[model samples]
Target: MKELDKIDFRILKILQQNARIPMTELAEKVGLSSTPVTERVCRLEREHYISGYHAHLNPHLLGKPPLVFVELKLQSKSGNISKISKRSAENSANYGVPSGVGRIRLPD
Candidate 1:
């Protein structure tokens, strides 16, 4: 991969700020036409600069109001993070957690 130029940096910064920005709007912001912007974006994707996009949801609307941070501590036990994440994602709906927490917090 070649060294990224100013245009490349601008494209990355803009996309990082708003992944959902339209191609035309993004081009306008970056001072380029949609065609070249699209090309650069495609090149960036091919080079693995952008991995994936996600949505931020309001937990309250999903019947889960409380938000809490959790820390996982491990002691000499090695586990696959991908497997853990997959299992948690599969069982999230049952526990009423959208995607962040591993457990549900019921009202007192």
Candidate 2:
């Protein structure tokens, strides 16, 4: 494996903050030409230093409802799930049950 240098670390840091940043801009920020920056980015990817990129969006700003999701791996889907779901929707702020994982929309 190739050892990562200062330029490689800079590229990673910049990409982490804004993965959508243009190559030229990123290169300029790291004080390198675009060609070398591109090559470094590719090498970083090949080395598994960069796994993936994602957006951290603000749901409220985007006009999205405050919905919460819970993930679970259930051994079996049971009737208790229905009962809990109905009761939650009727009574608590929970608003749903866990059929593996529940979709609970928070109250406004």
Which has the greatest lDDT? Answer: 2
Worst 10 residues of 2 by lDDT: 91-100
After best superposition, candidate 1 residue 1: deviation in angstroms?
Answer: 1.3
Candidate 1 collision pairs: none
Clashes of each: 0, 0
lDDT by residue (1-108, candidate 2, tens digit) is 799888888889989889999999999999989998998988888889998777788777877768787654433556476666565567344422444455556555
> TM-scores, in order shown?
0.59, 0.56
lDDT of 1 at 75: 36
Instruction: Give lDDT: candidate 1, residue 78.
Output: 47
Q: Output the number of the TM-score-best candidate.
A: 1
Q: What is the lDDT of candidate 2?
A: 0.76
Angstrom error of the Cα, residue 81, model 2: value is 18
Give the CA lDDT, 0 to 100, for residue 20 in model 1.
91
Where model 1 places Cα greater than 4 Å from the true spot, the runs are 71-108
**Per-residue error at 68 for model 2, in Å?**
6.6
lDDT, candidate 1, 7-73, per-residue tens: 9999999999999999999999989999999999999988889888889897778877775444444
